[model samples]
Target: MELFAYYRSTSSYRVRIALALKGLDALVVPINLLSGEHRQPAYRAINPQGRVPALRTDEGSVLIQSPAIIEYLEECYPAVPLLSQSLVTRAHERAVAALVACDIHPLHNVSVLNQLRQLGQDEEQVAQWIGHWITQGLAAIEQLIGDSDYCFGSEPGLADVYLIPQLYAAERFNVSLAAYPRIARVAALAEQHPAFIKAHPANQPDTPT
Candidate 1:
């Protein structure tokens, strides 16, 4: 298997941690997003969306989208389960994951920041835009994580995967973490885990700003 990824991408980071935790290995193809390598036709052939975190498997098939590829991994390698077998618990896990993936990430993706500049927004205003969504989304997650070690409960589930990446972005933007004690604690615990620590951007071979 091969993973085409941008080292600093939070979405890609989640998948990297997951892969490492499952004790699986994949060839890492680093896409230099800052240099527009993802926009090139050669990379686009692998993913028409021209996005990073594309996973190519042994059968010569490609999997796009972080969540889809992750779900595939969960199905294929269930030994180190990231989900609960119970339906209710799984729903709760997905809910927490979506809160970050669908809400927080899209608001602060590179395209949104670029668009903000296109609309005559300065760096300060662009930062405010990113902060607004992050605080709003993280506030709810902080509350959820406050009562439990993981998203649903004591085990590290899907929510932890999504939450750690969002927290990384929050730190990058210098978002105030004062009000997110629960989140901070959760991310702190996750970082101590070898998989999360090893999969960090700084540890990646091709880390770019």
Candidate 2:
């Protein structure tokens, strides 16, 4: 398997965590998003959406979107399940993942922030925009998650996989996690977990010095 990813992209980070948790090895194909590599025709051929985290499977099939690739990973690699077997618990886990994936992350995505800049929003305004959405989303997640070592349970599952990357993004944008103690605890736990450590943006092949 090959994973085309931008080291700093939260979406890519999520997928990397999932793969590592499953003990899967995939060649990391670095796509320099800052250098506009993702916008080139070569990457567009892999994912017309031109986004990072496209997975090319061993069978020679390419899967686009972090959600779809992750779902595929979950289905294909069931030994280390990222979700619970109970239907209700699975739904809850997915909900937490969606809060970050669908609700919070997109609003502050590079494309969205670029659009805001084009619309005359200054850097301060963009920073404020990132802070507001991340704080709101994380505050809700803090309430939703239980008092455990990881999000929703003692084991790192789907929610942890999603949450850790968002926390990284939060730190990157200077959004404080001090207000969310449960979230902070999860982050603290993840800091020591081998999978999380291996998947960290700082540890990625494309990470800048």
Candidate 3:
């Protein structure tokens, strides 16, 4: 298995954490998103969406998008289950993940920030744009986590991994985390889990660039 990724990409970080948690040995093929390599003809042929976190399966098929890839992983390797068996619990977990992936991540992605700059927005405004969405999203997450060690409880679940990278991204923008104590606590809990720790931006190969 080969996972096409950009180390600092939050979507890629999600897959990386899940793969690590499942003890899967997938090769990490880093894409240089800063260099626009993901949009180049070569990678575009592999994933037409031109996104990071594209996975090439053992059967030589390509899988795109974080949600689909993560679902496939949970199904194919069920040992270390990320989603709970309880129906309501699973739904709530999905809701929390969606709050970050669908609502928060899209607003603050690299492309969105670039578009803001293209529209004559300065760095300060760009930073504020990121912080605003994250602040709102984390406020919801704070209520969702509610002082739990993990987002869903003692065991790390899909919500925890999904939320951590976004928190890291928020940290990059110097977003104040003080308002969401529960979110902060959950992220701290994730740090103690090796799956989440290994996928941290600081631990990635391309971080210092």
After superposition, the stretches of candidate 1 with alpha carbons farther than 4 Å from their true spots are none
Sorted on TM-score, highest at the top, how do the candidates line up? Answer: 2, 1, 3
Which residue pairs in candidate 3 collide? none
lDDT of each: 0.88, 0.95, 0.88
lDDT of 3 at 162: 93
Q: Supply candidate 1's per-residue lDDT for 119.
A: 93
TM-score of predicted structure 3: 0.95
Best-matching candidate per TM-score: 2
The positional error of residue 26 in candidate 2, measured at the CA in angstroms, is 0.4
lDDT of 2 by residue, 14-107 (tens): 9999999999999999999999999999999999999988999999999988989999999999999999888998999999999999999999
Question: Per-residue alpha-carbon lDDT of model 1 for 40-119, expressed as tens digits?
Answer: 99999999999989999888899999999889999999999998888987887888889999999999999989998999
Q: For model 1, what is the alpha-carbon lDDT of residue 182?
A: 78
Q: Which stretches of candidate 3 lie over 4 Å from their true place?
A: none
